[model samples]
Target: MILLIPAYEPDDRLIALVTSIRTAAPDVHILIVDDGSGGAYGAVFDGARGLGATVIGHQANRGKGAALKSGFRHAGRTHPGEAIVCADCDGQHDVDDILRVADRVRTARTSMVLGARQFSGRVPVRSRFGNAVTRLLVRLATRLSLQDTQTGLRGYPASMVAWLQTVDGDRFEYELNLLLHATGAGYAVEEVEIATIYLEGNASSHFRPVADSVRIYAPLLRFLLSSLGAFVVDTAALLVLVALTGALLPAVVGARVLSSTVNFLVNRTLVFARGTDKPVRTAAAQYWLLAGVLLAANYGLLLVLTQLGLGLLPAKVLTEAALWVTGYQVQRRFVFAPPRASAVERPVAEPSRALGADVR
Candidate 1:
């Protein structure tokens, strides 16, 4: 098993973590990527190296995603078929938990194992709130209920190294992107509960709440903005068409056609299918089919709401809110999903002693 840690401006805790791992799991190869921690952290990296861990260097901070990829590439070249487990360098991850995740990777060899934190006990306010929001967004986006979307303790089989390297995002967003696309890429995610440790109220965390939050939630935010833009176009066109034609059906149809077209274009090029090789024509066909169904549902809901003593604008608002989640799910799972690779078949193994009940 290979244990990969990505460190940037680390402290003595890093050294202590390395020493503990060396003592607990001596055979596990430790690989650390110094993500441009510079000379100030040289002693820390040296200590890790002196403890028999190989250290990789990056000239400047390229973000956690880049550091992990560097470690993955190096592990592929050096360890070849060994299962890899990634843990944070700040000592939040227990050595026993690390070994547990490592064991799962070795046993499963086809699933992505996550060292999920319980988030119980005294957790930081930002950390708790951030995880909750991200967890909800991930569930909404992928229909996969993950307990911890932001955990750095993850395990991947050797077969997944190439695919992991292909995942996008250079920073914190990279981990979320991986979870979003993992099922589509034919990998199952299994979670193992680990202790949640917040040292000094997580002050050592380099995460910038505002900047990194935008990047992490960029996909969902883009879709939301696209929907809002289309809503404006749809509502305006609907009102104008109603005044011009005095027919609700024609007005709704015309408005939806214009708005859906705009929404489709933006979502395809910028939001869901960006940088993908999936054919535009194929996606368009799927998208239009979905739009047609949504349009019918939209019209039906609008008519029902208006008949229930609601004003036209109020009905429109209510109708859109009702269908918003449905639209995102269908578009993400079917319309814009990438082509899946062949999945490996493996038997479900019983949970290890460190493993907990599965999160819904």
Candidate 2:
């Protein structure tokens, strides 16, 4: 497997990181994407070359996304059969985890793998809230649960490079953009728990939560409008069902199932269909997953809002809005992101592991 490390004006810490990687995985190919660090820092990379690392230089600073693209292109040319793992150059990821993901990559064909971090250790408040909010948005988009939206440490099949080349968007939004593209293509994305080494409490971190989040939330924002319409359809159907049957639970559940299905269909075609190859069965499976979750979220929210004294009508209104936003996020991250072709070119014709389940 090949590991792509994108760096800009990398410090001594990054040098140490490369050295550590060398010690951990001697055979692993390391590509350092130098985003216009200039001649002043060329020698630092020179040191890396001496340590047995392959350095790919960019004459100018491109965003993180561009750097990753460069690395993917390099890997495609140099190591076609190897898995591609993307890790940040900020030294926040453990080298051990890189090796671990590499091991999984051998078996995880046709699936995108994520390295999930433990949030219990001094997570920034803004980070926690942002992740929670974004996680919900991703869930709604793709019908999958992702613990971290901005994680830079990830692995994917090499074919993803060709798939992502079809999409646009650079800068910090690149990774999230990749995820959206991948999930849209019907590829499964699953997370592997890993340790995060946040040195000195992330003193060198460059993440701007608010700004980056706006970029990350781009897919979700578009999906939200569609989901809102779905909610209205659900509400109207629910009221009609209640009028006919006077059965709140069954009526609400039926209406929600119908509405969420509309949402899933729209999302599948409009939002995610742009780059998906998920087998028809994969879509059906994901649809069922999405339906179950939507029922739980929408119904659960209504129940809680009623208990909180918001009353049924007002509560339904508020709850519906909340659930739509929540559902959109999940779908983006899990259902339609990081674009890749199904392991089999025609997954619908013959369902296989490449269809029903992600190779995670």
Candidate 3:
């Protein structure tokens, strides 16, 4: 098995991360994908090489997605049969977990194995919220119940390695794009809970929360924009329900039930279009499950907020905002993914020009 590290000017931290992998899994070949780190970081590669890692250098910074594509391509040609696991250059990932996850990938030799961080602690506030939103988008897009959709620590079987090279998203958001595309190609995603070390308060990340959040959720945002009418229906339902039942949980549930169904119907018919490689029966089940989990979480939050010295109306608003993030995370990760059909013979709906995202 080959361990793939996509690095751009890897500092001492990456050198240590690579070193730890060397210590933990000596049998696994390490591939450092250097994206133009300049002369200053050349020593890091030399050190990694000394510690038993093959360095593939990119002349310029081509972004994380591009680096991974290049690295996977290199692994395909060079290692050929060994499985590849992609790990961040940042030291946040646990080497032991990588070993464990990679072992499963090596043994099963099929599914994509993801390192899922325990979000209860260590995760930054912005990171938590953004991931929650993206996770839902992935659920809706791919109909895969993923615990941590944005986690960069992932293992891939060698058979499907080449397809990842053509997919889009060169930045951190590429993780989202990879997952969506993987599901579309009918690959199964497996989660492995990993220990996360957020050094220096997690401030070193390259992802621009708001801008990248838009990009990460690009595919699903388009779907939601197309479903704007459903948003209005949901808000209207909420207002009418509160007026009728004094903002009780049942009323909130009733409102969300009606509104979410409207959104679901629009997504199923419009965004998903029943023609992708995804199995309709399983996808539909995952869709309802995603909505049910979000609805429960939304209403539960409202109940807690209302009981904690706040007005029901404001509580509803706060909880709804929370749900919006949560719902997007679950739906996008599991629901709206591309299908496994080798080729889409007939697109059920023309790609909506109005809902397209500016990836650049």
lDDT of 2 by residue, 213-304 (tens): 67777666667667678868987898899899987789888897788778777777776665256665676676678778777777788778
TM-scores for candidates 1 onward, in order = 0.87, 0.67, 0.65
- Residue pairs clashing in model 1 are none
Question: Global CA lDDT of candidate 1, please?
Answer: 0.85
Global local distance difference test of model 3? 0.72
Worst 10 residues of 3 by lDDT: 351-360
The sequence of per-residue lDDT tens digits that candidate 3 reaches over residues 242-307 is 788875766767876787777776776665553244677776688778878877887788778877
Can you give the lDDT of residue 304 in candidate 2? 82
Q: What local distance difference test score does each model get?
A: 0.85, 0.71, 0.72
What is the lDDT, from 0 to 100, of the residue 303 in candidate 1?
A: 89
Q: Which RMSD does model 3 reach against the true structure?
A: 9.5
